[model samples]
Target: MLRGSAETEAKLRFQQASGPIMAKGVEDTAFYTYQRFIACNEVGGDPDRFGVSVDSFHAYNAHKQLEWPVAMLATSTHDTKRSEDVRARLAVLSEMPDAWTRAVQRWSEMSQTYRKPSVDRSIEYHIYQNLVGAWPIDAERLQRYLEKAMREAKVFSSWTRVDEAYESAVQDFGKGLLTDQRFTADLSAFVDSINRAGEENALAQKLLALTSPGVPDIYQGTETYDYSLTDPDNRRPVDHAAHAALLDEAAKADRKTILNRWNSGLPKLWLVVQALRTRQEFPECFDDRATYEPLPSHGERLITFVRGSKASKKRVLVIATRLRRSGVTDTVVALPEGEWRDALGQRAKVQGTVKLDGLCAGLPVALLTSS
Candidate 1:
């Protein structure tokens, strides 16, 4: 910056110089080496902190609403280590650490035959976590990702001094393990066990990203259950036709239909459409002047909040389960007095204090506004 008299030109030069340095050093090196709770190891994220408290979350949102309300509120970006849905799915492990540990141990023993001398436990561990996150990924994709990952870690192999033998063994391990029916079935069963809670986590994550204070940032293919990886992988083609078809389907579908198809990614698409329309319809509620009011929920399992006020004549109430609940508990939240309707356009009215489960119906999330 000091080299050139033109400040703008000098700053650009410095930015260009620093960007690659940061990417090569931190994004490439540190991200690979530090594998403790890898879900938190995303671009612009703290690797140590697994999750945040509702109070802290609310405080951050309130601060944004009061300060930089227009900053992009991103759950997933091209720069992320893993996609949002992938992270959401992986987060279920936090709830069942013992199960996860036992599964990892079993997986390692099952695949011990495939490991070469250079293929270390650390890389194998990383592979297992990533497999759960991006389950149902093809063998080719899995092998490709493994090569990239192992190389990035620079343990047994690296991009510069490529460990061809070790990389080959890792690839063979991926292919072999994938083909091994018993191992695949075991992994699949474990994933299926946590799948429901993962879906709930994904839904909650979706709503929070959309309704949080700041301009909501929607990444490509993220309107659905995107189990994507880092760049080039995340930037892969999205099916706009399918998205449009889902939107058309959502237009005529009833609330029951909306709540039934979490697996189809229709619910996620419905959420995006409704949340965006709400922003467009009620600009005042999301503007810099809008108020952020945190509401209290019974049992505190739900992170409840209202944006905007009566003075604005419109407000958005957002609700999402804070923890994974197996069956709906008798949770309740106090509501603003008026005829409340689903912002997702479900034909239902709510008033006064309402049971949380009844308010959300079958869904783990609720988006409402009042007339």
Candidate 2:
């Protein structure tokens, strides 16, 4: 071969051999993806956004209506870093940074002994937080989860170039965490403490996704509490029987009973069923050219909007909340003058501007339809 051809071929071979290094190059992609707000790092989402404000959210939806009109509004996907519930729990940290900082410090100290000497403290700290948020509370499940998490994190080890020594250390850490009763107890208590707020955030997100100006989707078994981690764990077999039973129960449930099941995440299912039923019954209300009027709310924590069709003269009012455990007392959303009835339940007429405190009493969301 010519001298130049020999050198070029050598370089090409070197590049081919360096494929593993090329793969490792994207390891920091996780950091670049979620450095702003970890919540937006999910598949198909812009990771640079810190968080979506109510106005920005409405604006985005409006733009979509004008442009795409059929965009997917989703909370969780198969490849999400953490499940939607975990992201919801993490979002709560924004409201309580002090509490989160303190909790992280306490959990790190509590689980310090479980960390392998070879493991970095920073990575260990992150692992504990994610585990607390998405932990399945099962030894085997958590073990598989930690292994995958540590590998994907690529801090101490990676899939392309496995560091058996470090990987073994991580496995050892997981085993120790499971065996240590004190560690397990503290972790469970911490998770339980944050889980209630997580539930609230989850419900609020569900309501927003379903009522927004796009087609809402419900992943399999998501109607119930899906506190899954990621991948195969998130892809666990769903109990359709139980879901069918819950749907049956939700169908028979009165508004009050359904509201009481909000914590169980059944109310979200109920909201989905009711909203889709309305959309199916009156497809014209969801037309791209239909009017979308965002109702003015008294507080930043509440988002209210109305969907309507001038041609068909149909309207649907949606009210959903945000933040953790926020009260709706004294908060009001302005509406078009008409008779709007709670489509999810009783047909009590709502007229003019309505006070959310009375309307959304003990409910995570409200769906009102025009008569």
Candidate 3:
């Protein structure tokens, strides 16, 4: 799997094998095995489950162990089962089984009258029929359908079948009337539920994996938002030219202020650049013996942690927020009672107990370090 562009083959092999093996002094053979097991369990019977739980477990565990100084964590990969947001929302189903079951029933009820079976109509076929025939579809069956769809979508495009890719695409569009309505309604509800549970679990897990003991790796555009989905879609090349243009524009004006005004995605790009700079400047902090401290905030939208090297013991503070808007907040840190600088803004000295008001407003993360 590591040799190929897709990790499916490796993931499958890792799951099928028994026990664990040693790989490059990093016990990954065992880690992969456990991860697959957990992933399978997390989505027992949901079409959108897609093993995100397993991915998260692997990331967190890998970070806990100092073996992989940097670990690449992702819910959406080229071979992922579903889109990241879709899977993230699906994970919420585990929290509200009854709601998930009832929603699936409604979706099936609404989709049963289609002329031709919906595209990729294997399990959904049975689900729709069962819902209409039985009046009330079995929750277990609905769950199974969700699991099957998630797995199958990984190998087959929902809009393309064996010899009927074009035909399926047409049918998909035709069915859009009903499918779109039902899907959007159900998915919106699911997203709302997930947001209520707090969007921090996934984000926090990613950051912990990134800055903790392991080698932190980022999946192309994931630093900004979750774009979970399978290959072709996930593998789509980033528009570096477009991004470069935005960067240039922002740089010409007040980079930070311009970024704050732009609603597109310049802020995210800026944050990624800042994170990269932080990693480059303070290699020692991420190397070993770093401490983690969660700050107290009113909204629970901000996450702050500090890492430092053991030798020089220089500390770098990271302040990350999940809020959609910008605001100020107070954070307490155990720095050496001296002036600290904001690395992203050219070593601007920050007073005691810094206020992160406009630091990363509208941005996903803010990387700060001591001078």
Candidate 4:
């Protein structure tokens, strides 16, 4: 009757019923179960999309230039479920799901005694991974975070109707398990392994955000390692004095050495400052209409590309890796015909064919300018 409605009352009834259905149809169409990847679960992003190929990324950039040139390139936001670094760490697990499953089992066995009867195994797995990715977390902080997560999950507790008993049980589990000496030690060791590989992923993405075609936004205190969770954790105060002191120290040192050490997120901060400086100095190179050229790479791991007007003589070549721990073993990227100086590094030059093993001796990615 509503579908065939021609009468005024029938048409009005159909409109009222269909409005919410249509609206919810779009809303519910987003990534649901696929959010397990988590890295792609950002606002307006499809979590089901595993990873973008280098070729697709270039195509996306080209489209961005033609259409949404003023898009904001971002990784973290106050409303994000997990911090960028946490997602970066978890992204590695996608490539090693079997290992992740085994680790989850081991962790569950290691901490099962502390869990309350109400605790769900799936939620436990989720909590364990979040803890590992966001390690160095103090007990008090972790408990508060867990409490919030529990309420948000609304399985045992909820924000509106307080399930005090269930909330307390979850808190007890966090307090008991997270505080155990042996558990902490094992957790730290596990986090160290993930960080070893995760840091490489972090660096690659950071470089892309800075050099890719779009206006990049650096959230507060994000220049450093941001392994933060949602809300209060991500919104924590920044020690500007400390960061300023680090920036001063970095200014005196060469970019290459800073990147090699990558100690205390100095390398990331340096990259930001250098890239922003370049953008500020050469607006034409990053113009909304600038041509995006994807450079060919002989290596399977490298993603190389150039951006800017070829006639302008001011161009930027960006080269980043896709994998972690692979390092520079037998990797080579084809370069444009000209002498290019490292824009981010101190003193590195390359022409024609560039060898990653030689160029990035200790670094994971590099940005270069034609000389």
| Estimated TM-score for each candidate | 0.91, 0.85, 0.53, 0.87
Q: Is candidate 3 or candidate 4 better by lDDT?
A: 4
CA deviation > 4 Å runs, candidate 2 = 1-37, 46-48
Candidate 3: tens digits of C-alpha lDDT, residues 1-371: 15663577777787666333322112211211222212222212232344343335334443554554444544445554333433433344454557656875676566555434434444353333222222222333334433334333333333234435533442443344334556556645545555523233344344444555555656666554443333444566776677678667544544457445543545444554555567688877776455444334434445565676657747776665543223335533333455666655743666465445555443344456664
Ranking by TM-score: 1, 4, 2, 3
Clashes of 2: 0
In the predicted model 4, the residue pairs found to clash are: none
Give lDDT: candidate 4, residue 107: 75
Better of 1 and 4 by TM-score: 1
Candidate 1 vs 3: which has more lDDT? 1
Best by lDDT: 1
Per-residue lDDT tens digits for candidate 4, residues 299-368, read 4577888887645887788888766654457776677888888876645777877677666656677788
User: TM-score: which candidate is best?
Assistant: 1
- In order, candidate lDDTs are 0.82, 0.71, 0.46, 0.73
Stretches > 4 Å off in candidate 3: 1-67, 70-76, 82-175, 178-210, 220-228, 247-263, 288-302, 322-337, 344-347, 354-364
Candidate 4 Cα errors over 4 Å, as ranges: 1-35, 297-300, 326-328, 346-348
lDDT of 1 by residue, 1-371 (tens): 25656987878888999989887777787788787778887888778878788888899999998889889989888888899999999988988888999999999999978877777777778888888998878897787778778788777789899978888987888888899898999999999998878888898888888888898888888988899887667788998998889889876766788777868888778777777888787788888788899886444467888888546578889999956744556876778877778876554777788787777777778888864
Q: Order of candidates by lDDT, top first?
A: 1, 4, 2, 3
Q: Write the per-residue lDDT of candidate 2 for residues 228-264, one digit (tens) a residue.
A: 7767788889999888988888787878887677666
lDDT at 165 for candidate 1?
86
